[model samples]
Target chain A: MTEIATRDAYGKKLATLGEIYPEIVVLDADLSGSTKTEFFAKKFPQRFFNMGVAEQDLMGTAAGLAACGKTVFVSTFAIFATGRAWEPFRQSIAYPHLNVKICASHAGLSVGEDGASHQTVEDIAIIRAIPFVKVLVPSDGIETEQMVEFLAKDSGPCYLRLSRAKAPLVHEASYQFQIGRGHILKEGSTVCLFTAGFITSQVLAAALELSNQGVSTTVVNMSSIKPLDSKLVVAMAEKHQYLFSIEEHSIIGGLGSAIAETLVSSYPKKLVRLGINDEFGQSGSYQAVIDHYGLSTRGILESLKKELKL
Target chain B: MKKRSVAELEDLACELRILILKMVHHAQCGHTGGPLSCIDMLTALYFYEMNHDPENPHWENRDRFVLSAGHTAPALYACLIKAGYIPKDEMWGLRKLGSKLQGHPKLNVDWGIEMSTGSLGQGMSISNGMAMAARLDGKSYRVYSLESDGGAQEGMMWEGAMSAGYRHLDNRVALLDYNGIQIDGFVKDIKDVAPLDKKFEAFNWHTLVIDGHDMSAIVAALDEARLVKGKPTAIICKTIMGKGVSIFENKPKYHGVAPTDDEFKIAMQELGDQ
Candidate 1:
């Protein structure tokens, strides 16, 4: 399986897109290299702005550039982009519905070795709460590339969450990407596994293991959290007896909450939400952290068995 | 309309102050002191300095104005009215539900408001982006932002100041309405943003200090700001908390409070409108 960090795909794809879209301008809050926006900065020196280490200034500046008929892409760490500069994001970009893409990298516990201060588990929840903001959490590199291209063409405020750790590719090269659409990676019956972000790889592996245990499982990659693919979720809820949501974020306001919100309104189902149980991340290797947080394949499989009473 | 003379501008300022007061009084909520202190600068910008057309608010080449101190939306609404962006009748709808005129200036580009900026310290950075875009697009339209002394206390404001300076966004002009007062108390008492001009100068901005209410001085400073090259300009306007109403002038108590009926009557009389 081809492995690549979502941030790498974001930076590379953004650089490629810059050649075609003259209006595409990039800004970073002094995390160009880390967030992978350095690729665009190096390629389009004139168009890229390093707004120092100020996230608020970065957001405000991006909104300003967007107002001037430029599609601005501002990059920073997820914690700072969505947490430290939330007000500017809410007021300047989201309120006016500016064409500013907040492509934040290093989201969730996968930002290992940096600890809780760096990991942003509530980004999706907080950003989704803001009006006129379309939240996208691409599961892998290929999806991140597709999301970057989609956002480049589309106008309005977007919060694209990218990951620091590399994940196995889950899509084909010719896979078509759509905004607010979820894809069922694997077909099954009895139970459905809803997942987003880099953790989808683990969830897919868990589903394969469950299949071997005579429990046919469906694997759905719910990348688009906001303007959620409710149609698909409702359909899955009806077809499957048991449901589960897994993510590398807090259980409160990430994939689990989004799915719960969707299911409770239309098709209420008892879902086993798999994620950090409202706890801050600790410094460790990506795999170590995932294992410790019970987000690994074995952990997910055990949780599924328990939830399904198997 | 031709540019008004200094005396005419002062009279216009008084009329704008009356409109702002009446709007706030009607709503029974708003930042009173800052708006009155900043009205003269706003009057000069709307009436003479800015290259904007009320009939064509989205004119591509027109100069952009951002009210960073958005609590003073009454002042901006009055200016928008005077500039024919909105009808005078709508002034009464300030801060009302479903009204175009929000408590903070929301981005109603059709009505000529470039950005929404009730949250302090963020507008200057937006101005920088606008200026950078102007440079990128090769357009000569200038970007102006009006911020308060209290707003300067925010770290983002300095970040914006640094970026504007680094980029040498000469087309961007920021006016710091140093009314020396904030919501809690005097700005000096709360957080001293004194020696404000030196701070801007240190940030590599072309700094200028002037009397905010002096129409000719405000107009001249704006003109001088345009001629400045290789750096953004910050015009520090020394102003009383409330300029027109003698009772409210230099009073921190009137910072965000609307005048009572009796005070409104007295304010209108003092402003020579009632």
Candidate 2:
């Protein structure tokens, strides 16, 4: 069954982890219910601390917990979790490479009515700049669940950017994810469609349309942007004539830019970088904003038809 | 461990000042004034109060030191070197290429440093995090942060202060170097942070106002900080900016700017003789 929501998946996963790992602690800036970290809070009251609308203190307290050899999962809105408390993560967590997971919910334009102030599009770029931080944007509910457990077990600072809206479960329950490796779910190499996060599902739909038009394509789930799957991308680019990268964030300095930088330095190809195209997203329903900004599956098909001369 | 005597701590503070000045002079640049003003407090912690070992800085039982007023790194670096935490000669390469000493105090390059702190008003939050972590672990080690009075005006500092007080973080001790001068001008003339004692007390911290220059007073307050069982302690030390240097003392501009060669010679001659 497709999961209710990525936030709901996070709730179930956090509760499961809390049961197994006694050293796991949950910290939320009063967004426990919204972010789905309330699962862990309910299961483990002593281990969970609702920091109450204080992002800076929340980040620091997470750092402190990590220093004491506990796996600390700090949950809040993406904007406040990554923006206001960036320094503490830089100074205290990433610099020290502590065992802290900065789990942020409602990433990108999916954060609906709260508008531009709360929707975090630049988070990937901002977090990717930090030397030792690992950025993870899981494609769906199942991946969010798997990645939370994966990051908790990995002994370093990691960010799990969660989506608020429900998404199609593209991967099977047994699907395992490597921390820095991208998986090529669809394989044929006339052109490579590369992407990450919930948007990868859109890329998959675009690939199906391109296939019927007799243009072969390869699709990659670029889950980890910082330690990108350069080897896989280079191989695909060498095998293909064109490269297409997409995301729910800016085309500048995000997954697309990261892949482009790798390809340009390694194996350059004809590429189209797709997303919000360096503009802030507006406040509206998820579908309205996606349609308004031309970041939908149809947008991907249109961009591909233009690139492939369909 | 035996506590340092008042006269002994006083003489130690003088030695620390002389060492700090020479360390900066070796590099020919550093924020000397603030460091000079805060050395007694730092000396009291490293030399007397805090639980740490130069041999094993990451020791689980060792007390943590977070320098929130990170620009005064020269002073901390000098004291670290003299006390044998960092190599003595590494002091010469303060901000040069590949040197552990960046403009601000960052952690892991050296043993005693717990976090990398450069931007103002940040270390308090980091220190609070570490203290809360220790509390959760049921650890006995205390976390202490040294922050400047002017830097304390950042809203984040108050946020951290509120968190510390609310959590009842008795294991944390934040020392406020109430040195009146910031880089722009006298703190009073620029952005007055006066009525500091009342301000910290209002934040739920046990406030202790004392002479930052007096070694005995600093030691006493640190002793008192240990006595406050369930609440964090904020030691507000009223200090003269550029205290030891005759020409630079009480001058706001000297907060970041170092002395010229002739001025350095005179300052050196005066400090060295004393």
Candidate 3:
């Protein structure tokens, strides 16, 4: 499987789309090189603004540009963009429903050696709480490209959560990504694996192992966390007795929490949430962190086997 | 829009002060001192300086005004009402439930509000964005932002200040309402933002200091702000916290407190119902 960082895909797609949509303006808070917004900045130097490590100003400036009829895209590390400048994001952009796309990169424990401070497991939760914001975490590079294209033509504010590590391509080139829709990777009946972002690839591998072990599992990508695929979640819940949610974020308010809310309200079921507990992440390699947290393929397979008694 | 003379502008400011007092007193919960301090500059911007149309509030080529110190929303409402952007009757609905006249300025361009701001330290960045947008689109319109002394203490204000100065946003002008009083205490006692003019100058802005209450000086400073070619201008307006009514003037207690019934009568008397 080919692997590409979602941020790289976002940068490439955004720069390409910039040629098509001249109205698209990009801003960054001095993390263009890491966030991969450097591509857009380098290509469209005149339209790009490096706000100089000022996340609050980045959000506000994006709102102002959007108010003036520019389709703006602001970028920075997830910790700074969603945590340091949360209010500006909520007040300036989301409240007014401006046409600014906040593409925050380096989300989750995938931030690796940067440790607990830089690794944000709560970006989804905090950003999702803001009204009028569309929260999207793409599963792979192709999906990231498609989302970038979709959001450029779409109106209103959106938060596109991207990761620093390269994600395994879970879909073919012909894959169609849409807002508020879940993509079913593999179908089965006994168990269901609902996952999002980079965690989907690991869940896919775990599901395949479960299939070989005679414990058939279904794989669904719940990328759009805010306007979640409730119908799909309900349908999957009805088809499978063992339902599980996986993410690289905290189990408290991320994809697991979103799915749990959907299930309890519409169709109640027992959900095994596999992700970070109420503890902070530590310094290590990307795979090391995920493996340590039981999010890797083998770790997830073991957890599933233990839960199902298989 | 016809430009008003200095005397007419001063009369308009006095009328606006009366309206502000009425709104604050009716709401019984809104900032009083800051609005009273900034009304003259707001009057000069809406009546004499800004190239905006009340009828066509969304006109693309018009100059943009962002009230950074949005706690003083009454000042904005008074100007919008006078400019005919909002109905004169809406003044009574200030801060009421379901009112467009929110405690903080909400972005309703039809009401002549360019941006939604109440949280301090945001308007400066928004103004810079607007100025950048104007430059990107090849539009020659200017962007003006109103800042209070309390708002200046925010770190994001300096972040935005640096960007505007670095970008050389010549079409941007920021007016600081240097009234010295905040909700807690005098700004100097709490966190001094003195030598503000020198600070903007250091940031590469054309800095000017003038009496905020003087209508002629307000107009002249804004006029001078427009001629500078390569840098944005910062016009620091020295003002009294509550300028119209002598009793409330410089009284920190009146910063967020509404006038009492007895105090309202005295204020109305002092502002003169001419």
Candidate 4:
């Protein structure tokens, strides 16, 4: 199995698209190296703008370029991109529906050792509230490449959340990526596991373990957080006896909250959310944080066994 | 559009002042002083200086004007109407729901609005982007932005200031409306943004201080701005909080408030219906 960080894949894809699309420009808030936008910058120096640690200017300038009919990609840590300069993102870019894609890396707890200050667990909730902005969280490197390609051709404001750590390859070369849709990685009737982003690989491993223990489990990768596939969520709810939503973010306003909103509105069912409970992440290795928060395979299996009394 | 003479431009500015007062009085909710303070510069740009076609507003080579002080949209609206970009009848619809003349300038290039701006400090950066775009396309179209003192208080303004100065965007021009008043009170009392010209100078901008209400000085400053090279220009226009109407002039109370029916009559009398 191969592992590649989604940010690495995103940088390669964006640089490749620059050759195809002359109008594509990239902006970063002095984090090109960390965000992996250095690839695009190194290839097309004239088209890249290093905004010099000014996140507000990064967003505002991107909106400005997009206003002039340039497809702009802005990159920074998720904390700074969505939290520090949120107003600029909202007023300058999203409100105008500019052709700017905000590809923020180091999302959620995967930022590791950087602590709670850099880990943006509330980014999905914050960006989702803004109208005309599309939100996406790719499960692996392959899906990230496809999503970046899709966004280059699509015109409008979008937020693509990428992880700092390498993600296990969950999709094969033949796997197709679609926006506003969910992919069912496995099929079972007893329990349905809903997950997205870097946590999808962990959920899949847990599902396999649950199946071996005589608990029929299903796993669905929900990469599109905004414009979510409600139809698929409803269908899964009706088929499975127990449904769970998991993510590498806070349970308040991320994947768990989104799935709960969809379920209660159309198909009412019991939902158990597995993620960081209403608490901030602390400084630690990525694996340690996920394990303590019940995001690791062993922790997830133990929680499932306790819940199912198996 | 045909360029108007200095006397004609001044008359047009007075006419715009009257239009703006009426719009604010009717809307019963809008900024008054900021619009009056910046109306003359807008008039100078629209009637005399800018190379823009009202009929062909989206023309590739036309100069772009961004009203960074967007609470002053009433002034921009009046200029757009006079420029034949927007219908004269829309003046009555200012701040009304379902109207193109929003409380702030919205992005409607066809209406002669280059970009949407209400949040301050962002437009300067946006203007830099437009200027850079022209350089990339090898076009000579200039970008003008009207920003206010209150807006300059935002940290993003300096961010944009640093970028424009560092990039040496000579194609960009920023006109600061040093109106000396904000919603709180006198700008100096609330927070002094004094030495504004020197500040721009420090940021690598060619600085100018002019009487904002003087049509000749406004036109001369804009003309001088175009001659400079290797740097952007910031023309710091020292202006009254309100101009044209005596009752509202130099009064900080009128910064964000509209006039009453009785006060409106007084203002209309002061501005002269001619």
Task: Give the alpha-carbon lDDT of every model.
Answer: 0.91, 0.83, 0.93, 0.91
For residues A1-310, could you state the per-residue lDDT of candidate 2 as single tens digits?
A: 4645677888889899888888898999988989988888888888898888989878777776776678899999988988999977787788878889998999988888778998888889899989988898888877787888887688989888888878888787788888789988799868888888877787898898898789888898988786888998888888888888889888887888889899889987767888877788889999778777767889889888987787
Candidate 1, residues B90-204, lDDT tens digits: the string is 8888889989999998888888789988999999999999999999989999999998899999999998999999989999999989999999998878889889999999999
The reply for model 1, stretches above 4 Å from the true place, is none
DockQ ranking from best candidate downward: 3, 1, 4, 2
User: Model 3: per-residue lDDT, tens digit, A109-183?
Assistant: 889999999999988889898987899999999999999999999999999999999989999899999899999
Worst ten in a row by lDDT for model 3 chain B: B265-274
* lDDT for residue A203 in candidate 2, whole number 0-100: 83
User: How good is the docking of model 4, as DockQ?
Assistant: 0.77
Q: Score the docking of each candidate (DockQ).
A: 0.89, 0.60, 0.89, 0.77
Model 2 over residues B1-274: C-alpha lDDT tens digits? 2467888877777777777777776677768788888888888888889887787776787788888898998878867886788887787788777988887876762446667777788778778877877877788999999988788778778888988888889999999999888888878888898898888888899999999988878888988989897799999998888888888888887788667777778877877745
Write model 3 residue lDDT over B124-207, tens digit each, in one string. 999999999999999989999999899999999999999999999999999999999998889999999988998999999999
Interface RMSD, per-candidate values to 1 decimal: 0.6, 1.8, 0.6, 0.9
Give the lowest summed-lDDT range of ten residues in model 3 chain A: A123-132
What TM-score would candidate 1 get against the native?
0.98
True contacts kept of each: 0.85, 0.66, 0.85, 0.61
Query: TM-score of chain A for each candidate?
Result: 0.98, 0.97, 0.99, 0.99
Task: State which candidate has the highest lDDT.
Answer: 3
Reference-based lDDT, residue B258, model 4: 90
Q: Which ten residues in a row have the lowest lDDT in candidate 2 chain A?
A: A1-10
* Ranking 1 against 4 by lDDT, winner: 4
Two-way DockQ contest, 3 vs 4, winner = 3
